[model samples]
Target chain A: MRTEAIDPPGISWHRVSPKYVTVRLVQWAIENLITVVVLTLPLVFVLLGWWRWPPLWLAITVPAVTLVLAVWRLLLIPRQVRAIGYAERDDDLLVRGGIFFQRTMTVPYGRMQYVDIGVGPVERGLGLCTLKLHTASPGTNASIPGLPAAEGARLREQLAARGEARLAGL
Target chain B: MTANVPEAGAPSAVPVAPDGEWLRVHPASPFVRGWVALAAIGFFFGRDFFERLLQGRPVFEQDFAGRAPWLVAGGGIVLVVTVLGFILTWYFTKYQISEGYVRVNSGFLFRQQRQARLDRVQAIDIVQPLLARIFGLAELKFEVADAGESAVKLAYLRMDVARQLRATILARAAGMVPDPARPQEAAPEAPEHPVLSVPPSRLIGSLLLSEQSFFVVVGGIASVILSAVTENRGFFFYLIPAVLGLAASYWGSFNKGYNFTAAISPDGIRLRYGLLDTQAQTLPPGRVQALKVAQSPLWRIFGWYRIQVNVAGYGAAGSNGETASRTTLLPVGKLPEVMSMLALVLPDPGTPEPGRIFAAGLSGLDSDGGFVTTPLRARFLAPLGWRRNGFATTDSALLIRSGRWWRELVVVPHQRTQSMALHQGPLARRFRVADLVLHTTAGPVSPRLTQAGLDEARSLFDAQSARARLARKRQISEQWLATVVPAPVVAPVVTPVVVPTQTPLPQQSPQQEGPQRG
Candidate 1:
């Protein structure tokens, strides 16, 4: 029961779909693994005697640096994913995220220009999507990642309806 | 309502009762563009001929006399192609004024249709390019609120028709019916009453008086003299482009600011200026989120100041190369004029002691005003403007006065503030001070207040956040005022007391009472 209480209280904070974790992890692995392979290619070639370097440290240093980065990113992925949450208020929507450099953005409903729902192949497989809210000021555009496909569509429809109504009022 | 109209095709093919009479620009628009293109081509040819002559070549005899027929044929083809392009462009571009939107369709090969909502129009500008002015034609520019990256522009209409269209659009945008019979009569005066004007002589004087122009002219002359004395032809030739570039920019600035005038209008503040090419811009009320009153260092010698505003749609409009939409309210003015312009833009200034606040923000001479000045530690960082770098707050706005040589006073309304944060670097942390930044939509306004004490910064953050939230909550949908007030309801004789359903607006928190002056 205690472990289930993952979200912040009172604000009704909504976490992204749990399937997003697997999608993100797979994406992270693919991206880092590609970089690691590309970076370690010369080292592999050198070790196999296909290529030669005068400095000789090239074989050791490149893979070592790539390995360090791969490990760091692998460690930070879950924390970064967990840090993201969003809440819908009466007049505004709030998005909070970031593991070290924290940010909380409040986007007033009246100022919303449009709402965009985007889905990628992985996200579609996981039944998740992302929502982007745009405003007149470029700095204030807020994006929420990893909502369930059904929830994302519902949110998009509601946000669009609310935007139109508020804009008409203006 | 025209659901049957296909998305892609010539609009003329499926005319569904002609949606409120589509208006095409002046017939001479293509001629204007053709003339401009021809002039450019002539300039290049003339330059080539002159360069050959300067090189001591028998250019006229060899190039023109020998190949006169070929030259004539080539010139004719070029002119024909240019005119063809202009005609195609003008033919494809047309605008339709529907009930709720003004739709402009343009482009020859790739069709582009932009529709600006009638209610969302912030302002309309009438612009005349050098060539267009000669032909008595103008372009209509619409500054539509919240339409990011896309603005509707209908170019090259007769000047009178442009004014009439602007009047019609503005009136419609403000939810007023345009009188059919008097459409052309008072429409010109609706946004064109001259409130102030800068004389041509004064404009020329200001241009020459600026230190940049003086230095450029002097430097060019000095270099020419030096090269002549040294008999260095190469050096002299090299300096020609640089000197000419400076002269051209100075001339451009002069032309852009010539005959500058400001006017009061029902829609907003109207401005008209230019020598060869004229521009008339209306900055609607409530569209201006922030303002900057600035005086460059040299302008201080003549006590001249300039004011600029962060009007919503002005900056984001795609550039038209006129330099008219620079968002300047006052390019050069005396203290009295600047003060009047200030009042015109930010009428409230959100304070009772407006004079004191304005004086402090402009001059920063008085220490007793409500402005919170930076501590002495700032002297090391800014050196010149540190003492005057301060901020003052009102119930609905924030005023920051900064700069020493090039002074600036920025006024940001609370509701317009997008976000705010306190930023402290390592040195700032050591000095126990931080910079407060208030984010705004892109424009000329500086978004930062610097070097406040830690405690003061924290208090300011808290107070500003609360005030901004409150202001946003109470924001009204309309920007204009009605002259009449509704009569108060009279309770029936049978009912002893009338019960009110809605509560009155909430009072400000006691802790957030009016701040005392420093």
Candidate 2:
């Protein structure tokens, strides 16, 4: 899963689980399920002949556009998931993501205050978790997603230990 | 623990002993603190009088003889209760200056006591608000290296006492032990060398030509034209608020920037400014986290520049004039003055030719002056500033320059860099260019170097990371330990930081030494 196009040499990069694509698709489906339900309400009312001033075609436009957007996002999810990756260097950690807007952030071990691991229902079901690194500067938002649960735990322990050892007490 | 209480009417005359003796602030502290309440009371009574006069009901003329007694009695009660509250607050609040910390034991019911460590001192500001100035008193604020909130605030101290206390506290924070034998001479005040002073004319001119003023003018004109075109008088109402707000903001900047002067002393860079409510700020060594030099398109005509800095303990500069003043280095300065202030803060620019490289960072372009600019192929991403936008490195600091019209230069020392980022958007990927951002503490100067070549970005990513690590490991703690550790004759040289790569980017190597500022 090493992307030859983006990964620099000398450091081993770790890609998130491919199953994350499914987790994200499920999460997206759950989030947009509400929009689809709400948008369908009006359409249902019109179909049932319950007082509707708007035309049937006008009502159809709303759900149609929503479905199109949902489909577009569904199509993009896999590549976006593939783009997510994190790397650990000697004295710092690097996290990069985003398809159109690629960003790589480096958080030095000394500046890290603590390490956090997050797991959602879908991620838990897929045996995946997210690892977040906190630094003194609030802007140091370095988080890695779709990490395997075991790998996430290991990385958290390793990062916490490294942070304590190199803590500059910032 | 037991402090001698001065009479509620009499002023406290204790000197800054630093002998672990608790001392009460000026007795008038409470009155000064209660000014808001007094103003509210004045408004209430004055409103009644004004309303009666407006109604032609004769406030003090017709019923004065009968109502005088009741009015006097009610006023007396209010005055008595207010004085009682003041006395209660005054009796409890006390502060102590010891060896390693300054403590304020205050609060009425909760009995709150807060202390700020001497070593953790970030900056000391002596503020004289209009009322305090009239009363010949000042407020001493001790900014500790905590979250931007001021740790210790000693309000309404006699002006002379506040100055002496500040000098004593700063000396202790610097780890200088006062010669106890001479109680009269507590670490003799450090001599100040005047560096630069901004003239009133220049300050006014800068204000008139500032970006805010430009926006205000544009907004005012647009609103006026709209009102005329639409023939709606309602549009005129918006002008009242906008003009009032603009007037208030202009006055704030004027009050804060008037007679701005910067000086160098052993303590740090001392800045004294403000017209009505004067402020003297002392930023000790290592307190400044970053620096930025900027120019507006309009200011280029007069060659005026602005320099601002970030310190750990100061809150972010906002609409408040005091906070804005805290971050400002030179409200309005010429190039030489700006350069001098920069030299003082960084001290070692880590270059054989500091002036030339700085000049390049300010205005040089086309990869001249050791700056690695964006490749020509990527000019499509930023056609206006592709030539001007670039980054450079001296031994101790990273210099980033950008903006074709409103030119800007940011300097972040390797040691002060909190973190860094490398990013490339889809557009940039096409041209094989990326942006590098060096993050410092919370401040206005966001040191982002844009459109660096892809290869250069990759190399810089690894190299800058290594440099930041090495720099942090070597930087000495800001806490001066003069009492224990002898001052080094020469300041320790940080790791010799360069671009690290031997082969410079194509045009960067052939760049000339001196700046060709447009």
Candidate 3:
């Protein structure tokens, strides 16, 4: 495989930090764990004889099935990380990522509603921060999962300045 | 400002002006206010019941022990809550005018910050509920485009302030200054169209003669009787006051309906109704996306029609904000006037053009467009009411179609269309006919003009979709052209530079020399 490097001047770039990626993964795990526990509560009750128990073999089968599903997701995490990438064009920030299907989304600095930068405990431990770009559309939320704290702050400042300039028609 | 104004016959001539005079909105309570009122009432009533219970009083005791103490405590609590409510209502509510927006900030705990851009605001509706009317207060409602879920409500504002804000917002939205030249003109005055006002007697007669109200009274009576029979024998005692209250309310509503008048103005439409809590909503025409003129079976007897519009940012029914329905252009239910009002509020569907075509070939006289096609292979598939389904379209994109046998009439304009859909059921597949529906951004005005012929409908659908897309593209392109400046062209001048000429002339071939000379 061969790769060529292109130097583009006056173009800005942003990257997600490792710490931010770790924080998001932890949050995702916590949320999925809650869902899993809620879904399995009935089976747990059945096994304890508090409710009607399924056949002994079926009872064993259900947990095994759930474990397989959980393990499948755990194995897909690396693929998910590899999918996430960012590129800055002349006028917009492009974030591209999807596990099974690849998608690239562009948010023009002029149209950005706001930028939020925050660091979770996990991200803080890893010395990384997350940057979220919000638009008027409530559902279409975009985020750069991880970036170094210093880089995140610098990107926030640059985005805010660009947004101000656009608003002022400068 | 003068410099920004376009010269005569200029292509882009719309003038952009500075922000208009600022107006202050009325201070109103948040949704939490109603919850607080309910909580206070519940607490007072609950505390009394609990006090009686603690004294070992029977649940059904007519004369309970410790009643006086409980009553005193309840009264004191009510008084305190009322005082607190009054202070909070006065102090915590405030709205203001920012550069190009109306900012409303309210609430004690969960703060709500709502802002509506002056330019985006389509209309201002003022609603006065029964309680607010007594205090000469009104709620100001703003209808804005692209406002999403934030419907602005200014609660308990002075009526004058609401009107002032409405005028200011309208002026700013229409891209004008608050011209001092129009000082004599009242801000909320209705237009003096010949059909604007219905005679007071006729209005009263219509309300009294309405069978709908009669049925409502009958329904209320039936419900009261049913409840009395099912709940308890002792409930009979309460029936007297309840019946009297019902009668009084019926009379009040009737009287309210009597003096009603609807009018269309150049700026917007105004409706005035109600006996106790009178309401006036000024709905600007440009804000209206869709207009619906409806008549019930009973209303048909009296040649009456009720008109409603689909507007954004107006509070929904039973919402915390000012009731938007009150701003209805015509509540008097006069058919001709309703039609004229609709024309004034909605965009023109354009004059009917010749060479108009029907997509659904032909079905029957009763079919929307008058034709139905059945292929030889698909004879088993036929619409149950083929006679009542079809669609027609004009070159300019006005579409009309009808179905449902009992209720019909759907018309739409192509410019407003957002999507086109085709559906096929198993039965439809057997007949080689499918349903084509065209959807628009406007609510209710979106017409599902089901053209019956599958192939023809698909072709027409493709054409209409392409037309709508082209119209949108043209609009965007026009805006872009107006804003973007083209780079100036520089003519290349061949200046005689001895060294440059010597180098270039030596390298040029015969073709190159000819082109350079030309």
Q: For model 2, what TM-score is found for chain B?
A: 0.85
Best by DockQ: 2
Model 3 global lDDT (CA atoms, 0 to 1): 0.52
Worst ten-residue run, lDDT, model 2 chain B?
A: B509-518
User: DockQ of each candidate's interface versus the true one?
Assistant: 0.10, 0.53, 0.03
lDDT of 2 by residue, B240-336 (tens): 8778888998999999999999999888889999999999999877677789999999899899999998876776776655677888989989899
Estimate the TM-score of every prediction: 0.71, 0.85, 0.51
DockQ preference between candidates 2 and 3, better one: 2
Off by over 4 Å in 1: A1-85, A125-127, A148-170, B1-19, B37-100, B105-114, B146-150, B180-188, B191-240, B295-303, B316-325, B363-368, B372-390, B401-407, B418-439, B449-518
Better of 2 and 3 by TM-score: 2
Looking at model 1, residue B400 earns an lDDT score of 88
Expressed as tens digits, the lDDT of each residue in B427-490 for candidate 3 is: 5544556556553332334455443666665566556655554443333211111223232211
Q: Which model is ahead, 1 or 3, in terms of TM-score?
A: 1
